[model samples]
Target: MKFLKYLLIFLAVIIVIIAILAFVAPTEVKVSRSITIDAPRETVWEYVNSLEDMHQWSPWAEKDPDMKLEYRGTEGKVGSVYSWDGDPETVGKGEQEITSIQAPSRIESELRFLTPYESKADAYVQLDETGSGSTRVTYGFESVSPRPMNVLNLFMNMDEMVGPDFEAAMSNLKKLVESGGSSGETQSEMAFR
Candidate 1:
């Protein structure tokens, strides 16, 4: 019984340490993924900047084919928003707005989700010339959780949850830009970015 008591004490100490570490972790977590596309930076930038074009490339939209999506404000400009409501629990409901924009270069947006769980985040996509014909596209999302536990949970699984979407979006962007029109990427990992 003495060994059991010691083990319990050790476990409790470890849990406390983890909770403290989670509290000390950054309140705002920024997750980003980047890839090089064999296309002009401007082409890649144009496709990403337009809220209306997101239906063709966003992974979450692909998850629910019947999701109701709406567009508001002028296309490809600041203040434009893309709102989607999905029946699939995985897809959920969300809105993305262009809070700031600089065409063919950078876009900053406010992302709000209303289903599965309600959350808000700052999203940005940046395009940069990497080589003579290659462009590096970087996508990032930053969110702040009021509770330490929420931050800890997001910290543990965010990369795994969002990385593939970033990869798929980049792949689609690359194919559309390089092909001068559309993509043949049937799945998330089928195309090169």
Candidate 2:
């Protein structure tokens, strides 16, 4: 009986220590990653700005082929929305609404995740033409969590979790668009106004 009591006490103490550490951690997390693409700004913009064409090089979409997707807006202009429902652990599911867009230059969106955790984030992608037929693309996201999780997330890296996917998607966008064979590609450069 005494041995069982001691074991219980020890386990309780360990759990308490872990909870305390998580509470003391930072209250929010932010991550940003960028990569320059070997493609024209116009080419890269077309891939990201349009909801329908996202499938061509989207790293996550390809992850779950059976994921349900619904899109809104005209092709890729501003006010477009992309929503998907997928397996919780693998893709969880979210809706992204393009709030502002500046064709071949910048796009900002509100991303809301509904599984694992419910959170909203501001996501943006900007492209700067570096000449030599390349665009320096910067993708960034900021997420804020509440209370204990926020502090715990500070110790964890959201950028690390999400940045690799962004990097690969951008790379694929560069290759697909510049190579000039994607059916979604439009002849004219995207216009922001």
Candidate 3:
């Protein structure tokens, strides 16, 4: 009975400590990665402004070649949405909707993850002209986890978890744009069906 009493006290102390830590943890998590491409900002924007074009260089698409994709609304403008269903262990399932656009400079979107977990994030791509024909592209996402769940942020490094994928995708984008391999095709012409 003494051992059981001590064990209960230990577990209670651990839970209390975690709850206190949760109050100190950050509620918002942000992850970003950037890359410079040997292409003009406008040229780079052409590929990123549309979901279909972005898929041509997406690392997740490469991970699940047979992933199902669906599109709604207009292609490159605000309000467009791209949804994908893929390997849960890799790409999972999500939909991203274009929220705003500043042609040749930035595109902001809302990302909603459906499988593995349900969550929402604000995602953005920003482009800056670096030189005569060079552009620096920054891809990032931010999400807020409320209250107790924010405690996970203490144990998880969002940047480390998502940064490598962003790096690989940026590298792929750079190669695709530099080599002129993306084709700048319309969604109907290059659907992933």
Which lDDT values do the candidates have, in the order given?
Answer: 0.78, 0.75, 0.87
Using Cα atoms with residue i matched to residue i, what is each candidate's TM-score against the true structure?
Answer: 0.79, 0.75, 0.88
Q: Tell how far residue 114 is off in model 3, in angstroms.
A: 0.8
TM-score winner among the candidates?
A: 3
Per-model C-alpha RMSD: 5.4, 5.9, 3.5
Query: Which digits, one per residue and each the tens of the lDDT, describe model 3 over residues 30-123?
Result: 9989999998998899889877777777778878888899999999888999999999999899999999999989999999999989999999
Query: Candidate 1: where is the Cα deviation over 4 Å?
Result: 1-22, 182-193
* Superposition error at 154 for model 3 (Å): 1.7
Give per-residue CA lDDT, model 2, range 1-193, as digits (tens): 9999999999999888767876777655666667777778887777677667665666777677678999887656778889999988878889888888788698888889988678899888788999788888777777667765665675667777787888777766666666665546432222111
lDDT of the structure predicted as candidate 2:
0.75
lDDT digits (tens) for residues 82-111 of candidate 1: 998888467888899989988778889999
Query: lDDT: which candidate is best?
Result: 3
Arrange candidates, best lDDT first.
3, 1, 2
Candidate 2's TM-score: 0.75
